[model samples]
Target: MTDAATRLATLAEEALGAPLPLRIRAWDRSETGPPGTPVLILRNRRALRRMLWKPGELGLARAWVAGDLEIEGDLYEALDQLAGLLWERDDEPAAGRPARLVTAWKAARDPRVRHAVRDLVALAGPGLPPAPPREEAGSTRGPLHTLRRDKQAISHHYDVGNDFYELVLGPSMVYSCAYWDRPDAALEDAQHAKLDLVCRKLALEPGQRLLDVGCGWGSMVLHAARAYGVRAVGITLSEEQASYARKRIADAGLTEKVEIRVQDYREIDDGPYDAISSIGMAEHVGSVRYAEYTGILHRLLAPGGRLLNHQIARRPEPDEEAYHVDEFIDRYVFPDGELAPVGRTVSQLEEAGFEVRDVEAIREHYALTLRRWVANLERSWPEAVRLTSPGRARVWRLYMAACALSFERNRIGVNQILAVRTPEGGASGLPLRTRDWRG
Candidate 1:
């Protein structure tokens, strides 16, 4: 029989193109390997003992975090390969009948945090719609500063290396837009369709000035400027993202038409933009200040100007399990983010003095988008592991899995709302579509 060392060597030779560079140390009695093809497996003494005694995925992940399991070379790819051969790929699993019924019951009530009682209510009682928003007490604090800080929460995941993101995100790196209407569309096509859809909804015209709030790496801004011939200004709180966006704009020779600002939306004094787009940013506005947040956009737009508030929202009425799972995302992924249902969103816009013209739900589309992202991330895990620590990799893995689950289960949704600000009490007669335009 081959010894453990020889077996590992043989496995390494077959799996990886190069020989393994294994290092064993008494510091925690850990073994680690360098980056390369296949996986560079690392095992600590504790993990080794555990594997010998009993084996489980939880044990494996824990060992990896404990510095027991290490991998080198394309961590994302390694993970992907392992997932194809190992982990269950189901989007959502079917619980037993009783458990499913219980979960179904819990998901029927819209509550702060669904308790067992709520589940009973969902199972036994009539469904209640989501509670309405209260009057704005308004804050004495600066909303712009709050906006910037809120942006940080949204951009946190974006800092997880563009390469890792690229593995999961579509080729266009358009983080916000994905067309869910077409089930068979490619990521690039879906994203482009989303962008075009937004442009159409906003009624983008050549020479129209556009503002993108919480613009991620300037994807929307760049696309609008180039495709629609609009002068675009994008604001983001992420310094790294702002720098990257600026470089991208420069590279595309769009410096003349596109401006990337590393500042908070509230701090922006220059506006009266022809249109506004805030994709995936409204969730961070907090339910408390929804009116004010939208009001600010309305005030900044030109008369008869339109605004697209693209965000994740909950259903007007939701069950207990959905509430529980959504709260989990708030604590782990979004931190300060809160999602209001579409009814509340529209009502808030109306309260802010804007007329809601349309509402679109891309929930199913986002579910598909997230699944693709997961597949991409899995495929790139090997590279991801090599570039990042096990803890980081696990965090992303868990986050992606949770997000995918959230979309699949309808605990969350994305809304693209087109709202128009009436001109001076509905007096202006601006043409909806202009034929004569200057580029």
Candidate 2:
């Protein structure tokens, strides 16, 4: 190996306690690590210089997105290995202050270390290339939960082209956590089951009216209208979603039974609906506005009417700050999105005068759902790339995979909370036995 390759290898060993599972090939054709392993090719010196300049996951992600670094072979495995190395490093006990100072003094005095540091500094100096434009980045304007800003955030994510979403989400077009009755069930079947599950939990009657807040692609609205014989009204902030959902309702011949509106929940004055369903949209409602959201749902539903809220929640961790994965998501994916704990969600519902009936944790089901989405995206990679930029595709791939891992590890949770608006001195209107809804 050349001196540069050798130095990198040594740095890897020192930092990660072992050489990387993949081989690293520098710009000069200098190679290190095992030949048969997966290859991580650095296109130019800027790649290494970027790593030294920012020195963490962000730097690596920037390099990969900017086309300075390329990974050959399994992309998932490469990310897994990278995460494992970071986990191991964090698990190591920290040295005392004096010991760290002594080590730093020794490193600063080493002639080879000095020279290497100077070379990296010069490479990453003012002449470094500017960061590529993040066309997919979300908006950072206005207050968190205002009607205007919420629309902007929702549009930033869901308006990325219906064709692109179709490529990733499959035919069912369900964007929420699916209910997989069996391990080998198909994606469409699982999504159907999830929609039926929500309808069942709400116990819709033949002529009752149902409102679906933040409905994506009108899946729930169509399902309720077709299967449960209910008049459904679905609302969303994305004009693209509203347009596509209307066309779908028209094609399904449910235009009279189902309605899609590009309206905000806060502005809805027509209410007294028999039932309401809010799925996968509460995360965008900041914790500060969670009470207001639940209050709105409570007011919209008729007395004794059921409200089913399905949302993703963050699991309680000892070091709360350490479990924050929203930094990357807020920048590249869902801007201003916040997840509250399940307990907090329940409390908000109760505070809004809704009696909480049931809270079902479907964490593993979301893991399965995300895994299927990643598989679908991989299968349609060519179409996906044609519809969107390569960097945008990579963002979805990495974000979805990481979320699946997070769900599998119990770092986060998805829950369906069943609540009811109870009249004064009245019962909850739910059946005494849970088996009544199972059928």
Q: How many clashes in each candidate?
A: 24, 0
Superpose all Cα atoms of candidate 2 onto the true structure and report the RMSD in Å to 1 decimal. 4.4
Worst lDDT 10-window in candidate 2: 95-104
Cα displacement (angstroms), candidate 2, residue 9, comes to 3.3
Q: Spell out the clash pairs found in candidate 2.
A: none
Q: TM-score per candidate, in order?
A: 0.65, 0.87
lDDT of 2: 0.80
Best by lDDT: 2
Off by over 4 Å in 1: 1-155, 317-328, 425-439
Candidate 2 Cα errors over 4 Å, as ranges? 1-5, 16-22, 34-38, 84-126, 136-139, 317-325, 435-439
